[model samples]
Target chain A: MTTLQAPDTPFLALDVDRVDANIARLRQHLDLLGTPLRLHVKTAKSVDVAARAFGGGTGPITVSTLAEAEYFADAGWTDILYAVGLDPHKLPRAQALVERGVDLTMLLDSITQADALVQHCRTHGVTIPALIEIDCDGHRGGIRPDSADLIPIGRRLADAGCLRGVLDHAGESYFATTADDQRAAAGVERVTVLDAADRLRQADFACPVVSVGSTPTAHATAELTGVTEVRAGNFVFFDLVMAGIGVCRVADLALSVVVTVIGHHGNEGIFTDGGWMATSRDRGTAQQAVDQGYGLVADIDGVLIPDLLMVGASQEHGVLSIRPGSSRRLPHLPIGTRLRILPNHACATAAQHSRYLVHHGGSTDVVSQWPRHNGW
Target chain B: MTTLQAPDTPFLALDVDRVDANIARLRQHLDLLGTPLRLHVKTAKSVDVAARAFGGGTGPITVSTLAEAEYFADAGWTDILYAVGLDPHKLPRAQALVERGVDLTMLLDSITQADALVQHCRTHGVTIPALIEIDCDGHRGGIRPDSADLIPIGRRLADAGCLRGVLDHAGESYFATTADDQRAAAGVERVTVLDAADRLRQADFACPVVSVGSTPTAHATAELTGVTEVRAGNFVFFDLVMAGIGVCRVADLALSVVVTVIGHHGNEGIFTDGGWMATSRDRGTAQQAVDQGYGLVADIDGVLIPDLLMVGASQEHGVLSIRPGSSRRLPHLPIGTRLRILPNHACATAAQHSRYLVHHGGSTDVVSQWPRHNGW
Candidate 1:
């Protein structure tokens, strides 16, 4: 067995058992709703994790970038959906994937993109499947379900034989401070996307798939009556942000960065080699009730060091100190002491590393390595 | 010629001429003070940029990670300094670099680290050179120069034949709101590192190099009288943060992310493919007098898009909107229209990509592809 002590400091560590549990819980919840899971591969960006998500079969996975679509497609997961709004320049790449017998679906929320994609398909004599992004919570890209522009956009895509479904992400669910608030936001997400699909079908457009999710909404939504698929990525490694949203407990976080204590400052602060580069600058928990500064500091065994928070971070250094209003004295960790830090957002933090050091069943032993893809 | 329209959307573009001019201006300023510029390679982790910084000769460069040191060492940059404080677990990697005939110097700020190094050297019979970090500003690491602890730490390292120099970084200079404040911080940095070096020499320890710099101080400092070396990394690519500090004009920024307009939001917001994944989450300019949101919007020709800022970012989407109080209407950028965005911090933004699309002067033609090293 490979131990954590063997690798160099400041590398991402993944607990396989926690990951398995997190995935199982989400799968079970979605399965009970009769909605198939179209797992987003953006969070882990690793084939090993995606393989497990596929459950030993060819997958219907979603991707944020075409690079990820290419990676997972090459790995035999041919049914892929590129979730971000489509840019016309990427059509050639999308065409190449389609030519390879991969069922790659693109996303768009505007008539301008629809017309351009339609013209491209006409010029090339090849059809591309696309989804109309619906604005569920006003957090990001998407058209309002009731907007007068929504039906025309879908009609235009349907004329080009490219319209596939409707998708919405309740990203604002992450901002909800309580479980009730998250559930309410999830409720809003479901009705909004379903309304858009209903509007399209009423307009004589074929709307087959209705997709809605965000990690918070994925776990909080009470029903998936009209939704055919649920897409959530971050549950494979629940993070401090998920805990803040009341969706998962801190103990469920599977991802952390193993760092070494490099120095001490005046008995009030400890410095580690893990900084924004290793941990990322996503302060997702800042607006939560109990703000975990950068992340919650944990011992090597994954136990939270009480009251210790990464108060600040530079490029390559993290300042570990006692949280405000806490009377706990700083731990006297000597130089070279190894510790694991739970991140604010698993997706953001995991994107910083190229690979993960896997440990099985809460053990420090490194069971295997998993590589992740980055860049466009 | 490979133009901006040739590559996929959301890739890093580098203005080679601006990079050259920025480096030349800083080099000329330091050369007048008779201080050698040990360029920090952490900003643009590319051999192409480092070769230009080294003026076509072997480099005396500084790195924030050992991975960078190994990269440049393999590329023929022998004189290297790993600026982050030493962690014992990384010593073996450092030793491997030294054994391969690389002059790699480590950094430490505590006596505990000194004693550990002494024991490691005694056990292996190998001598490793190290620098004592001095705290010029209470921004991050290093012991205060005037503290009694400084002399003992230096003496212990000298006894182990590992004491090489003293180094400090006035990271607080970034918080300075005016040129006078930046100059004052730079002055303090110069004197503090010099004081530590003098104390070491008085205690019969050989303190050869005295290094200090931050991008703001590098351009604002009036003199480097007693300092042997000045290390500045971000000057190679000035950013919005430097512009906020009044060090460099916005025209001097050489790096930007080229992205395509994918959608429009309510006639006031435009969405692009570049997000925190492409631009990074370094909001260094947030505390400055003028807070450029995520980044300042620019055209493909590197011209500023007036009153436009990237107001918010998700994992793979950036919301470009008019800045608050700006009466300018949003530009009518159709889908597929390409634009560039100037980042807040060059170091943080540059670390997000695998390679740079280099363009000579402001030309859209691609001149070269420079690969960068990432991860530990």
Candidate 2:
């Protein structure tokens, strides 16, 4: 019943063919490493697309939220690694997932959390597998790989019967300025995880997985020695951020926001219904060299105008100004002109929508709809 | 069984008692104005909360999307205004809503849009009431109320037999420095609508309803003058942005994100699981004298910590640093610490979750859950 009947404005549209190509390329790229890819589900919320990613032989996946793990686990995605650091309060939910027969692996970075997990399993009568998060590049969460007593904490968890392996995300790879930077970061991540694994092995713990992944690093690194699997998301529908980082070309960026031109402020700017509310306030690549304000504004044909980015964004209204120093004013697009904007961060942007309007065969008409999840 | 029983580290939690109080205040405020308030359904997407909002008085409401209009209309809140600027491409959805006997008012700013709407309506055999947006201060959408062609466009729509009264949103008042600024902006909005109504009247057109609203202006301005109804939405659950602008107090902010301290970054900083993903990327009051990075981080009891504000936020991690220029580091909040954060913009932050964990009777334990809308 929900068809291509979209307002001339901000709605998420997926090109089925483009998505297929993106999935295939990622599959081919990861296949060469002789390691299985654990696709991260945080990037695309749609189980339909996630299922397509899963169909490519990466049944195991990483999840950012318990809601994602729950939703996908309900949809038959059994192997899930909750990449977010474990919260003691969520022990019940993690135990519930385990009770549901999900191979849910949680991440923890401290002894306090390890003790809490041990206590939760002791109290709840459920054993939840966990991976110790190691700091690869100090981007976000994780304990330093060589921290005193950290490996003993992993041994303590295994003694309590819940430890799984050691993992690292190499999140700093997102900041890599070039492929070489990505490769270097990837090597650092491999070393960090391998070192942590070695320490755990020295403590007589069977560390089966040494996880280190990110789309850029996954493509740049040739070897994953001492790691059992790789995990990377966002390769399915790349964004302007990935394009700017040289991880993928703009042509390979499959996702886009369909918006309508409601009105224009003459030469000053054009107004679209796609504001922070629709396109999301995720200016993921703003810290990079070329700041894509909200996103790179483009026409429906996927042609990047290079002179248009949402300059000023309010809650429900976006002001698309001509890129500074560019002599171009937008050709008087009428009140109904439809435009597509490529987002800066695919994960954050995609999380803002409820579903994907799948478009097939280059038509504006949406042939199918795929629902998305919002909470944990 | 969706018990947020000790929810994950960072997530949004709603206080239903506060929501009720907030709703009561809106009703009392509008009742004092001797005009009915068209509750903006954009603030609370839950149909259940929307039902609660309509419980006090009139059922007529304003919505940001046709999807919302349809959702609430199906729940029997039929008088809906798709408040965003209308696009001709969405004519079919408009037609469908009208055909189902939903009183949907569409907004238009330019005569170009009017022409297209007229053409679309004639082609589709659907009649939509047209509301001309009058710009009060140029914060966002609307034609300048004093524009020379105002009467001509109104008369054109009148001739076409689909014209409604002029509607003006004093959005600029939301950023007012003082009560006087809000009052003046409200007065200007009133004057703009009255002047436009007079122009239409002079043209022998019957302007049934001259509407004006914005929470700041609507709450402060006592006089309605020529206005028939007020459409103010965020008055239900004002946030830090509203508090910073002197419109509402922080205590009046009904929504707060409940988060957990995952780990400590150093001796001085505590890391929480709530990030931009949970609190939203809206730094609503940050541009004011005080910068609420993500929000004013609070304790479970809604007590603000003078030592900290969320200084930096990533997708799933928030760094709580000691306030800048402070003499000392914060007492590091250890892992598993539960914290509640007052949001900068309630609407944006609340939209990130599927369901709100509603706490009852000043209890830290959740008593109920309310579902929220994810998309149109």
Candidate 3:
């Protein structure tokens, strides 16, 4: 096998076996729910890594940027949903994708965006599939299903022959403290999007697709009678945030930053070469009951160190400290000691590097290097 | 006059004229202090952007990673210092740069690291210059200036013929709220590094380089009689954090993420196509008296929107809300209206993109595309 070390002090490492298991676990749940998975490729922005999640097939995928839509198309994946609300200036790139025989779908929640897409289609003589974003839990962007503004925007898309359906993400599901809470959030997400889809159909807009998901909600969902497809990205490499929400356990984390001990402060903390630049500034856990400062420390073989957490960071330095009130002695990790750090949010931390050093679950041997489509 | 805009909604925009003015402002201050500037390239990471600071001549620079050290070397720059604490695994990359005739200097603070560098030099018959980091104000990494451990660490490098002098960064100065507080921090920075150099000299070591800096201290230093160089990177593209520290004004910020209005919630806030992905999760201003949530909102012409701040963000969504209790009616930014969003930390924000969209001051015109050295 291709096995070697990076020689650099900090790099991202991915456990392929763990990745496969996480994907299989989520797929089994969706299989029972009778909904196919439209894997969001935003978390792992690599073609090779996403291929592992598909298990040797080009599954339907969701994207956060046009760059991913074009990149996956070039890599021979056909179906894609550009999930972020559309900006008018990006219609050209969306046009190029549709013209190239790719099943490109755009998303929007405003009449202005719908009008822009209609105008672009008329200007270029093309058809770009689109979906209306429905806000289920008031997390961020999306139109309310019960609002009077829904049918007008749907009428614009339906008249332009571009309406796909309705989709809603239960963003609050990420903070659900129990499996029952996640399940309730998932059910609310389905009802909200299905309500919008039913309203669009009542107005004679053929709403064919109904989508619902978020990492926590995807796994917690037990039924999907009206949902056509579930979309999720972070489940393929579960992070501390997922674990905090009770969706997954700490052992299921598939991604980590490999760093080396460089120095130490007197009774303050141990310093590692990895910093916010290696790990990201995504302190997603800061809002949780117990904030894993930046991330939890693990050994090179992916074993968690007891009560030790990354408490502070600068640009290129991380301070590892024992949890407060714990009498556990600091481990004798001298200079040049290699360790793995599990991140709080996989998407944020994974974006810090351009490639991933892949290994199997039982071995630290390098198996491959997967490049990411990191920037727009 | 290359003036066509990026079809993408969110991209990094840099003001070249503002960059020149910021660089010149610091140079003028350092000129009175009799110290040359060793421009730290970690912020912009773009050769074109750094070229603006040098004014067409190649000046000495400091880097945070070996990839930067190698990249700047290939671009024909000579003197470079890798400013982070060194890990022994990176010795080969450093040796390769030294072999390629780049004046690369490394930093470290312990005996184990010194012995490793010595072993590598002895095994390969090559000399690698290095600096002993001194801890001033109980910061992250570095030995105490008066500690007896300093002479032993310095003696290792002096015996191996690779001793350069001492360096200390007044990292705590970033929190200073007054010019006097910043100046006092700068004064302490100087005394600490020079004190370490004096200790090395007493041990019969010829300490040649004496370095001290941080963005706030570099601007606050009024005298540098014994200091040879001041290293500061964020000064070239000041952010809200520096503004909060009283080091610069809000108008002095030169980098921003230009985004288009995508959607909006009823009374919560306005939504943009940019988010934590575009503006990074660097909430550096949270510790300040006035927490600029993620960043402050600005118009396309770099004018501030009154009392508007980015209060919340997701992967591809930013919510612009009015500061609480402000009666300023929310601006009527319809869909497709483009605006600039200033960042909380320039380095973290700049790392989100692969290239910069360069323009000049007082004119909204694209002049160039400068690529950045983003990943390790």
Question: Model 2 reaches what TM-score against the true structure?
Answer: 0.93
| lDDT ranking, high to low | 1, 3, 2
Pairs with backbone N, CA or C atoms under 3 Å apart (clashes), candidate 3: none
DockQ of each: 0.82, 0.58, 0.85
Model-by-model lDDT, in order?
Answer: 0.90, 0.81, 0.90
Residue-level lDDT of model 2, residues B145-221, one tens digit each, is 67876877787788778899899888788778799998898898899888888888887998897888888888878
Which ten contiguous residues of candidate 1 chain B have the minimum total lDDT?
Answer: B50-59
* TM-score-based ranking: 3, 1, 2
DockQ of 1: 0.82
| TM-score of each model's chain B | 0.98, 0.94, 0.98
Q: What is the TM-score (0 to 1) of candidate 1?
A: 0.98
Pairs of residues at least 3 apart in sequence or in different chains that clash in candidate 1: A2-A366
Candidate 3 contains a number of clashing pairs equal to 0
lDDT by residue for model 2 (A1-376), tens: 4444454457787877877887787678767877778888888866788778766343888998888889988888899999988888877788888998999999998888999998888887888888999888877778787898577679779988888898998888988989999999989989998988988888889888788888898888877767788888888788888988999987787788888889777578788888888888787777888887888887776677768888878767888888778888676677777788888888778878878888863666777878888666
Query: B1-376, model 3: which lDDT tens digit per residue?
Result: 6442454768988998889999999999998878999999999997887787788778889999888888888899889999999899899989999999999899999988999999999999999999999988877789988987898888899999989989999988998899999999999999999999988898899999999999999999888989999999999999999999899998899999998889989866899989899999999999998899999998888888998889899998889999877898788888887888899999999999988888888767898888889767
Per residue, candidate 1 scores C-alpha lDDT tens digits across A157-247 of 9998999999999988988878898889999999999999999999999999898888889898889999989999999999998898789
Highest DockQ: which candidate?
A: 3
Q: iRMS values in order, in angstroms?
A: 0.9, 1.6, 0.9
Model 3 residue A86 lDDT score:
91
